[model samples]
Target: MLLAALVATTALTACGLPRSGPNRNELLAGVEQTAGAPFAIPVDDNVARITAYEPPLTFPAAFRNAGVLGPDTINAGDTLGLTIYENVNEGLLAGQGQNFAVLDTVQVDGAGFIFVPYAGRIRAAGNTPEALRQIITAQLETQTPEPQVQVRRLAGDGATVAIMGDVGGQGVYPIERPTRTLAAMLARAGGISNEPETALVTVIRGNTEGTAWLNDLYTDPSLDIALRDGDRIVVKQDDRTYIALGATGGQSRIPFGKPVVSALDAIAQAGGLNTNLADPRGVFIMRNESPEIANALLGRNDLVGAQRIVYIIDLTQPNGMFFAREFLIRDGDTVYVTQAPYVQWQKTLSAITGPVGTAGSVNNALN
Candidate 1:
């Protein structure tokens, strides 16, 4: 009788404790009666309410305001193709013909100056091809009558951006023009090595930096911000994932195939709950919320000490499926489904039946 009582007590204890996660029923019950405790929100009526909550990340505002598009400006180490024209009849650089023209290719020196025949060394860097043409013409007109100049950029590596990380091609990509965008540079680098949904782009503009999902940059027009010279773009594969445990087809950490993953999707990705053993009322998403979100949900700040939150969803109810479809599962969240109480009874019954069957078989063999 004592053994039977002990067995019954053990079974009851198992039923009281959640099979997947820690038994937080007391904490949940406390919050249900009062609001000052740690939050254990049921996903029934509050799914839509918490949808407005954002992750605590300060996305920098330097990504906006695409600078005005301008012609390709010269940079130091650039090769400039200069075509100079002069009137031979009265020009210092006069040739055999009445009209004199000279085509010369010059490299901008370390000091960002290019040497001309009579203009000496002119500052070629920071000026566009047309701007350099005007400067050369102004200097030549002083000595050579009717000197006309045209400048063209041959090649420049300093005006380019560096692309590294998880891209198919990692190298220096030229800015080409002033209006070159982040997406344009990504294209020039052969896109990313992974799917857009599973990749993110980080733009390192000097000390300031910004990150956006590759899918967002492609879909959201505003997120496809402009790229700057000397900027380093890295296409990193997102290793973000959620862990699925307990009575589910899969219990390992699962990577998100899409940018946003819902509770229903998470369950489906885990091969749905283990139908035979899963407890319909014990589906949960466990995660630590930021302090701001915890305070907002609990309605009081000082009372709740920690931001650890557990969201429960009962799959047996009709409304549960609807709520689960809308409840988003964030990165690093733990999705767990508890085993049903009846499954424990099945285990006890099998244990008892195995002994009884063995005794009956031995007695029959003796008879």
Candidate 2:
């Protein structure tokens, strides 16, 4: 009889007994006591109504001149078409490849400067093709009268940014003039593979990293940012995922995918809590460090302090519905539902027997 009882207890624990540790019920009650009971009146004036505030527009400096700038300057190993018009002879001298003698089609050196027959060594790094032409023309004027120089970049240098993660194509792409925007880069990579709107695009430029909403950049004209060389774009699809612990329904991961998720949405995703064991008043949402939303949640207080405390929400009363809707859930948010006190005994019994259930019938037979 003792062995049978022990085995039954273990099996119950493994299957999630109501009394094991801080099950759904006891945790919820403790939460209510800690975070104050929800307002009793259906429309309590004391309860603060969550107001919807428009998020301020954040613009990145990169996208200012999207189409304004022409193609970038040519680099070494890149093929080019050069034409030199000698005013004295009134004849057009053109070269197809780098061996063109009239225009001196020599490769750009490691120092980022190119050497022409009569132009000597001139700096071409960071200068556009047009800019380089003007420099060469000015230099030629010192030797040839009214000289005209034209430089066309046929191939691009290896300088490119890599787009990875949930994008359609994951590889390095050459930086084109019109393709400097984040959206443009994403399009070149064959667009987003999944969750185009919910995709998280991270720009990793050297050591500086910034994350922006891909949908916002597409819809909101103000948020478009210009991409730079060596930028890493990562798109991720992570919706339909929620964290559940303590006193919640199903005690399993819930999948939800929407433009925005609220505290209520999270609760609903977690099966709306185990009413039998949950403490309605003790609901909390834990969010990772995000400077953008920190100011609105904790006011102007020290962000470091506000970041440490989990945002507590009392759902015992009905008025919490409005507040829950106003509270926006960000990525990687953790929702914890507390349980009641009586469920603790059930947890103790389950803990003692949970392992036995996993060991199988052979172990029970041996015992």
Candidate 3:
């Protein structure tokens, strides 16, 4: 009679029983009475799997082709060391006793022109050291017989890339032979200060900007693009993250530990699911998928912008674990696991039986 009464009491109050969160049935039975309801998708199809793999970080074609300047190439704001050698005793630039005249620290102006004693204003920004030497010698041929001009390239504010953020050294580095490419420049900047798997490198040049994963920069030679003068390079950790909640071991906003995070990896990172309470059939990944992917999945095109998507992966299925391993987790996604249906029943019985047993013990003590 007591057991029957307890079961009846539990049946009456089961709706009020406290639970961690809604079960899979409640999560799906939610009525979409109005617009903007979350779409529930099962991550069990090729379309869904393909949609999960978004494009990775890339360097634009223009950035890759911009090309770096030669090691000895001159640019505006570069300092030059010029020496004019003359054979005659009476020369244009040679000192009284010396046959060669040393003109140190010749500055290139912002307009890409440099002025010599008798060579007049000449364009030096685009010319290499050897090429500029010939131009200077030609200029002094009329004033001094067979003038020999030697030009030496000097480092200054010229043709430099500003590297900042998570690097061993954050400063402006000259784009010479040692630092002409993106990888070389990053190395010259003392490598990355953070984990390479989670680090990102961004290059801002004029009106265009490009970015790539630091790890990809090493594996993919094409991503190691040429550096441009005045380019801004910043190395920083990837800000992309996702949320893990419900029956998982931990529930928090977990930052992506690497460039790519698979669903299996995400589950592992969250310390795996609570095996005692988790429903193997109710692991879900929810996010607002792109309209293109959503349309492709739903076989419709009316939807625009980002559409709500809830992806389920059932570990109970034969190929479920393999599919989870293949499904990728994107930034800002939510990974949730529903508790088994019996869990609430267990809670309800415990709730009623605990109080009943305590009251029975008090009665026995009084007797």
User: How much does each candidate deviate from the true structure in C-alpha RMSD?
Assistant: 4.1, 9.0, 2.0
Tens digits of per-residue lDDT for model 1 on 1-367?
9789758866765565434543234435654664445456788656546744655322256666656335577887778787777765655554666466555668888778988878888998888888888888999888877788878788865467899998889988877763378887788888788777778788888899888788777677777777666788888887779999888898899998877788999999999988898887888788878776676776777734447677889877889998888888888999988777677667666665677799999999999
What TM-score does each of the candidates earn? Answer: 0.83, 0.64, 0.94
Over 4 Å off, model 2: 1-68, 72-78, 87-105, 109-111, 238-242, 253-259, 274-316, 329-367
Best by TM-score: 3
Question: For residues 134-154, could you state the per-residue lDDT of candidate 3 as single tens digits?
Answer: 998888898888999889977
Per-residue error for 332 in candidate 3, Å, reads 0.9
Cand. 3 TM to true fold: 0.94
Better of 2 and 3 by lDDT: 3
Off by over 4 Å in 1: 1-38, 55-61, 88-103, 109-112, 177-179, 303-306
Report the Cα lDDT for residue 280, model 3.
Answer: 81
Q: Cα lDDT of all candidates, in order?
A: 0.76, 0.63, 0.86
Per-residue CA lDDT of model 2 for 26-79, tens digit only, reads: 434554563533211112222223222335334345443433324665654544
Candidate 2's error at 319, in angstroms? 0.7
Which residue pairs in candidate 3 collide?
none
Residue runs of model 3 more than 4 Å from their true location after superposition: 1-5, 31-36
